[model samples]
Target chain A: MNIKIVKTDGDVEGLAEQKWVYSPSVKTHFFHPENLVEDVNGFDDSDYNGVGAVGSPACGDMMKMWIKVDPKSDKVVDCKWQTFGCASAIASTSMLSVMVTENGGMKVDDALALKPQNILERLGGLPPRKVHCSVLGDKALRKAINEYFRHSKQFDRMVIEGSVMVDPDTRITDRDIEEAVLEGADDMDKLQKKLKVGIANKDAYAKAEALMGKFMEKYYG
Target chain B: MKISSQVNKLLKDHKKHDIYLDHAATTPMDPAVKAAMDPYFCDKFGNPSGFYEIGLRAHEALEEARNKVAKILNCSSREIVFCGSGTESDNLAILGVARFKGKGHIITSSIEHHAVLETIERLEKQGFDITILPVDRDGFVNPKDLDDAIREDTILASIMYANNEIGVIEPIKELATVCRNKGVLFHTDACQAGCSLDLDVKELGVDLMTINGSKIYGPKGVGCLYVKAGIRLEPIVYGGGQERGLRSGTENVPGVIGFAKALTLCQDDKDKENKRLTQLRDKLIKGLITKVPKCFLNGHAVKRLPNNVNITILDVEGEAMGLFLNELGIYASTGSACTSKSLDPSHVITALGLPYEAAHGSMRFTLGHCTTPEDIDFVIEVMPKIVEILRKISPLDLDSNEVQEGHGNLHYK
Candidate 1:
């Protein structure tokens, strides 16, 4: 043990162990993720009431969530997810999945109301730059809850974060335009190709193009 | 007691289940280099600039170390100047020329390290025209491109001998020939090349060269710059006129001695160590690509450094893969967004003009004295299993856009 490591400073000559940089909570959730999604292939959604996907590979992080809701109590019975992201992102989704189902499934509305901060607090804290990774889980959970509301014919209960009704018939919102931009949509033509929002409504389409410009500047600028 | 022979002295038990494969980041000091340095710290504490007997001895040791470096580099002892670190050497080589020239055009490559890139950028902002040539898909600087990029106003060109991230070796001699015919000075950062490549400045035909100690199993904070005679440079640091008035500071006596010893040992064992490391490096690259799906080598297959194996694993992020490998006691580095302070992925991968997504999955494993064939096998055996676990938790379907085929025989569904 008296080899005297060269980089160690004065009064610390015994040995120096390079510690791992993750917190215990983050480490545990990353290694053993909970409620992971399994491919049921042709009819996987049959076991869940709703499914929603968020973010995109273009942004380097994405999340997909599926929830099985019990109609009797209007509560989530099971929640499962998969993330195409980094360590904090995977851990945040795993922690979010466990949070929604730990006490026999949180109420559907409460799960919908959850925030990224709540998940981050439970997992100690993520690296400051990685705080954006946890936000995808909150967005994906809300998207799943919205799907559940639409499936149950209670369209009034559908709540999307930071969205306004951009089109009535096609049901496309400004959030769809934002997501399109996040996926590398730089112009109205690309946005129209992806969402097909401006065909039937010209005036709304023109306004939609303006909104797309704002989003492109916000995300890319 | 510990074993006292050469083999026992050089090798030790990896007691903590740890394997450090990130040699490009920095290397542990060699035991012999440490032994050579110990005297300067405690027993031989004399200022090399002082006029006393103790000072004269320190000065003599410093000159001896400088001569050893100069001999390996095929330059005169007076041409070598010691500086603080590799970055300082780079800054001096670049800013010194820029300052001496007053204002002119400079050229560099896109894949050069920040030490060279940032220096050119700073010069560009000072009303100096600059051109950054692009690399080929496999990360090689085309000499013909340099031939065309040289303008009548071009005063200098700086390039790296070997890239640290992808381990790609540039055609330095051919590129320097182009600059020579164009009547321009050529500088090269050989910081990562000292372990494997030849450092003969005459053979390379380079006017300015930068090399440091940390990457070559020597002490840190000591760097040497080879400046050919008659090429005037404005000194970046102003002080007591040490290092021929180029870098003026109190000499790092211990560090310089250790650096000379390390470089000597590396050059003495270069042929044997390079052969050993090349076999292990190729084994690692081949095994990782053959076993893991949708992965491919990052740099040139044949022209790479002997100890670097960089690859991109599809359907998984680099930092996640690196962190998992760390848990299993395999240490490596990633070019992924999360591994760095910023959200941008590695510039080296992107400079190849490959798919941007490849940068997100890029991981680099640089071999060192401790790497073995068993370590390569251990990684190959464990990588695919780790990929499968992460794929189960991943929603990325590389099947949608772009091409379907991968160099590693990846099949997407």
Candidate 2:
């Protein structure tokens, strides 16, 4: 005796039902984000050696992070963040803040080594599409580490070479073009609007466009 | 302050209540419609094409449903073609007309559901000329614009009777009149309008119209297309030659019965129910805007559907808000459920000239037969607090004085 099922748009028999299920930890952190900094007014610039922000509001995800370090120990004493994103983003940022500041904070070098997969492991997991959200906190932390080195005047400690503002006064880097393209400002006009690339400097703009074209081919192809 | 107090009181009163406000996606079957369809599914089950007595009875029942639909649309029963769903009806209307003519131009608005939009896109890929007319900020296509878009080779103009996302009812009669004068076939995907608006095809002057069952408290997977008697269409599917050879398959007898019964019930007290829904919808809209600052309505205030209240709260993600509401016993939608899985902003909302942030922040609440003023009150009471919570955490609100001045600085967690 065999039973047959009819496949319809609204299948009442529930044969092929699937849904995106967020882990309990993700739900918990999303509903109540930990160590979120709502106002940055009180935290003075002198007290924090590193400040980093990444993502864009126009692209639907933005995160701003600030870290306070102990001078003698060179450890992240406190970490806080603000974000405009979906549940996964908020949850990931919250978990990252806790991870960095827990046990009297992690060493600067160790914190920079944190990856998105580590954060996802701590938070149980996220949906496949939301795995990108985990990257936000890790990227912002790297930016903060680089900022820390730059602020301390220890240029040798700066590891990641990120995009720099393109102008006649500033040197244009290949990383700058890559960053601009990744942010969806691929064309010259968009690059100018986003990063002010080639503004008042024809040589820089032309160089940036050529590098951007190569990066687009390498990454997209 | 008054709005906040009202919300607080409602929250205290109905903390455990479950309210559903996403009726535009689909509605529960009406009991009468279910009853009408029950016999056909089991005891009265028979092939309508069979020559025996039970089969003849099923055939009569099928025709009776068609007649009921035709009478409502002021068309002959022969003109009504039942298919699987509204998407199928749309495909048949657009593809059918285009294939019948072999090659020509077509005009459609930018705000059509993906069914019409994707169908036109396929035709374009197949070497057919297609013109997508832009809509005004209010999601309305100007009649003169449609007239101007029609070329000598234009074969059809397809516009939706009402939008599913923003709920803006189009000027269908005027648009159809323009197509008629230009000697072009006019089609409207009236799936959303069947339960709320007039269905008189003669009054609308459209060459074709599409209707769906699930949207009107009927069973899903059954839809109808009203093709004018003289218009010829090439069938997309070839099979047992059911549905006048345009749609080939065994007819869904139970679904047809339920659809007809649902249509009759919805029309029975539509005016009164619409009035009730309109007042509740307006109250919800007004309360949300006044209580929750920095929010705006999406579509035309007056020309929109009676049951729809779509609003965008600045600096908030609609999916997050929807999840928050779902945590409570309340259910709503950020946009069409079909496209909600994708993180991209709603195309309909973005077409209205809203920025990406605002489009991503839009939420739609549609009322239905079971909606009540109390449900509206509950939503109003809880909505402002939810918006406030989400807004406090939103990084977009950091620069706005409203967030800074109103909250007196952000509370660090």
Candidate 3:
């Protein structure tokens, strides 16, 4: 009258199997998002040191991050986020929130140093197609750091401007070259026409083209 | 002894408890069809082209299967040409006819399966003029639009019987008649519709129709193209001059037998089963809309397939929902499996004029003969919790006025 169900090692594995098309760490964070601000009203107040948002619903992925910083120590006191995206995006942002707030919070500068690879590594890994999802979290965090500087009137602390260079004479930037390639300018000549790169300095044009080739491999690959 | 025990353990643990709802993607083979195909694999195995008695038997079995399919389709047996799969049948019909005519115009809908759409795209690259007709809000193509788009050089028009994503059935008879009046050969990919609807090819007035085995509980890798008599088609894959030189490959006897048996079994009880599936479909649709707020049904209310229930739950990614449902042993699809991994949203959902968010949030749950009312109840019971969890973490919750305002500004910036 007693039904004895066998429980083997395989059965245990089946029970603990990952269900999502994501790594185990991603599935963990997606289902149990750490420091996820469930209520927008809770974080939309003036107490938040900075708020950063990236992506758009129209683009099928969006993220918003809020950080509370301790003024005395210049460290993040709490970090929270909300995201509308696939499992990878939600998990990436969730891990970002936890990473920033863990261990008594990262220093404002240290949290800004966090990269997409750091978040991705914490979440094990993402599908190649979904690695872009991890980028949103780091981008949003950097935006929050910039917002903090802008609000605190510490414009000199911003470091992103230094990486984005535009030749003063030619008036072209790495961003311009990247945008040109993304907008269907494939070859060097097409990029030259689109950005007018060699008009002033021919050496700068060669440098810009080489830089764009590297960016293409990094982004397109 | 150790390996044997391990094998036993693995076998016992691998027992499936899933309540499959992705029947539109494919179906498990019916037992009757499997039984019919068993002999062909061994005892009766023979190349239909061989000159011996065994070969003649296989040839006869192949002909019998063709006749069974033709009977259900209300077409002559000679018009039926067996092929590998629905995709292959579609490729043969589109590419075959287009290549035979050398160069001309082709018309298809924005919602056609990739088999037809991609084929037409390739044809376009080869100097053939192509026009992709748009669908209405309910994913139905307008007959008037087809009539207006027909040109003097229009050689062929391919439309789907029912959309695989939204499940809305097109007005095939009317659309085909429009093409007929304009001297255009019309083709319909009826792979999704063969089991759920009456597919009398003569009544539908399609010059060419595509039907597959796996969609109707037969084995995969077998389907047929119903080419109306006297329609010229060049061979896409030339080999043994099988299928009367139109298909030209060694006949797949076992797959053909299974397909025929499956089609007969499906046609025999389709009316009663369709009624059951429609009731279950309605219950699931109604339960989801009532339980899950900010959710709406996709596709037409009554013009869709009886087995199909597609819905869009706002502010949640369909892939996330699908994964959650999978944990509860409910297998479903967010969109066409072929395009699910791609970054681009479903073209079929987007073609219905839905906004980007709604299209990104669509899920399709197609029912079948094995689907039951209890399964529907289980899905209804669990779906709301999943939706609530997803929406809680979602950045955009339109129900909250403050969140909507915040999201609007963020979007604008």
Candidate 4:
């Protein structure tokens, strides 16, 4: 059956039919012949700032989303994937990859708003029962973005050198600021003492302390 | 006359004899069998367990029916244990043997009807190890694999005489021999094979076997489980002392008579009936293969049941085909109706290693003594067009442009 894609941002308008034989396990990704392409390239492996992967073999879908953030701009500059699932699965991942890449500087909030229904409507429409299949890709995209941030924290610890002014003009490396905020604070009282530490160009440090205070009270209190 | 409208509009549109291509599910009651049952329902209805003269007559008639069933199977009447249906008979054979020994392992195939597989699975869950033998592409289980799979812990091996879905007959004699040499109990769910194929319990060397009446144009709700004279089994369903105390149900007198008559009739005309069914089955199989592109037959071409023609058509959903055919007043089924709502294909199809699309498209046409040439002709004429129409509206393809825009309004008067 032919699928005529409708020109809507979030609503897909066509129904496409593919003949798929049922198999025992729904875990592996199946690729159609016409859409097979070479892997995405052009990103430096060392520059890979973050990566996210999610979904489950139990659910019969899995997606590994890769993101490379430019150190200078603090933005996601590149993304790609190797997804394992059905037609809706493959389509959703491919669409999520495009959306994430287009919004290179998108905050996590914008990325999470990528609804599964929007993915379905974009691909025309999925079989009513198969709408749930779209959720795997959308959740995987958000998870990959979260993972990228996690990996970025680790990379900053290893590569970044110094802290900048807290007053908002200076470029403060994520690691240096974090290290300074954590420095000399062995116990809660030391952190509280540092919270009271007054220094020139310390707005960023103070802001960092406030954030850490929120985390500490939420977790340890 | 567009396709979707044609299906959605028409429910029972024709006066042609409703071709029931679902005999593997069950066959219509034969008149002769019903006639035999009539006497028991009227005067011979007294309980066989009673000591009075009328009861004695009922007892005599029950024995006679059992003897007739035994005669058809070439076994002694003492061996037949009557039960509710093919499934219950299967439960008795598999679970009875397993429960008798109280501890041994079992070996079975993946394609066996749930009557065997599900019982074996329950045993597995209860600490009994099970080796599920696999079938070849033709839906035949290899005897060598049975031999190789047998272990010291193995107490019984149960394989179907013929697959209910694909119609492929198993190598029962060979597998039975393997079980015999290993000193293990062998059980064949001969529910499908009983009416169509010759059953010589002595020749096959099976310790236990299962057979059903409804499948052979007998009444539903009654079946037979054959236990060899020497082998002992515990009653899984306990109750009154009946059927030699193995199965305790008050003998379904009418059902027993009908079952015996059906078995006798099958045996009486085995040669002629098989010939007739094979001719129609071959015609249907060959016609569908030649006319339908991308269609793959699902079982052994010649060694299958005489009346089974299972084919997997590419690019069309079997469920949709079933729905479309239903619109045409055609009665056909896609393998198992058990998991139809789940959108997953039959587990039997998956066990055969068929790809997802082909499994989803599988359909079984089981002919019976009642199936006619006209019915075959009607199916052959309408099936291809149905497949074409369903495939045109299928959404599994990536390159299709016709999105099937409207839901309905293309009504046919």
List the candidates' TM-scores in order. Answer: 0.84, 0.84, 0.86, 0.64
Q: Write the per-residue lDDT of candidate 2 for residues A1-221, one digit (tens) a residue.
A: 11112247655333124222588888778777877765445445577778887664434556778888886898899887877667777888899999999999999889988977799999998765566555668778877878888988878889845555444322335775686688776567565443434433467767878887887887775
Could you give candidate 2's per-residue lDDT for residues B1-413 as a string of tens digits? 33234334534565454577888888878888999999999898999989999999999999999999999999999999999999999999999999999999999999999999999999999989999988887889899999999999999999999999889999999999999998999999999998889999999999999999999999999989999999999988899998889899989999999999999888877899889889999999999989887777888998988999999776777777776676655778884211254444678877776555666567999888888788888788788887776666666653233331222122222
lDDT of 4 by residue, B1-413 (tens): 44334433433344323567888998888888999999898778899888999888888889999999888778999999999999999998888888888887899999998889989999999889999999987888999999999989899999999999898898899999999998888999999987788888988778888899989889999989989998888897778879988899688989998999998888788899899999999999988988876676887899989999998775445655664464455667884221243433577776676644445567888888768888888788778776655443332231111111111111100
DockQ leaderboard ranking: 3, 1, 2, 4
lDDT of 2: 0.79
Model 3: per-residue Cα lDDT over B1-413, one tens digit each: 22223223433443434578998999888888999999999899999998899999999999999999999999999999999999999999999999999999999999999999999999999999999999987889999999989999999999999988788999999999999998999999999997888889989999999999999999999989999999999989998889989888889999999999999999898999888998999999999999988788888989999999999887778877887777666788885211254445788877877655666677899998778787888889778877777776787764323222222222221
Candidate 2, superposed: residue stretches over 4 Å from native: A1-21, A40-46, A160-221, B1-14, B336-339, B398-413
In order, the Cα lDDT scores of the candidates are 0.82, 0.79, 0.80, 0.67
How far residue B143's Cα lies from its native spot in candidate 1, in Å, is 0.8
Q: Candidate 3 chain A: worst 10 consecutive residues by lDDT?
A: A1-10
lDDT (Cα, 0-100) at B358 in candidate 1: 74
| Deviation from native of the Cα of residue A3 in model 1, angstroms | 12
Q: Flag regions of model 1 displaced more than 4 Å.
A: A1-18, A40-43, A160-221, B1-16, B399-413
Q: How much RMSD separates candidate 1 from the native structure? A: 8.5
Task: Mark the regions of model 4 whose C-alpha exceeds 4 Å error after superposition.
Answer: A1-221, B1-17, B336-343, B397-413
lDDT of 1 by residue, B151-227 (tens): 99999999999999999999999999999998999999999998899999999999999999999999999888999
- TM-scores of chain B alone in all candidate structures, in the order given: 0.93, 0.92, 0.92, 0.92
By lDDT, the better pick of 1 and 4 is 1
* Native contact share for candidate 1: 0.39
Per-residue lDDT for A103-210 in model 1, tens only?
Answer: 888998889879778998999997766765666687778778889888898888877445686754234579877887897778765665445455335666887898
In the predicted model 1, the residue pairs found to clash are none
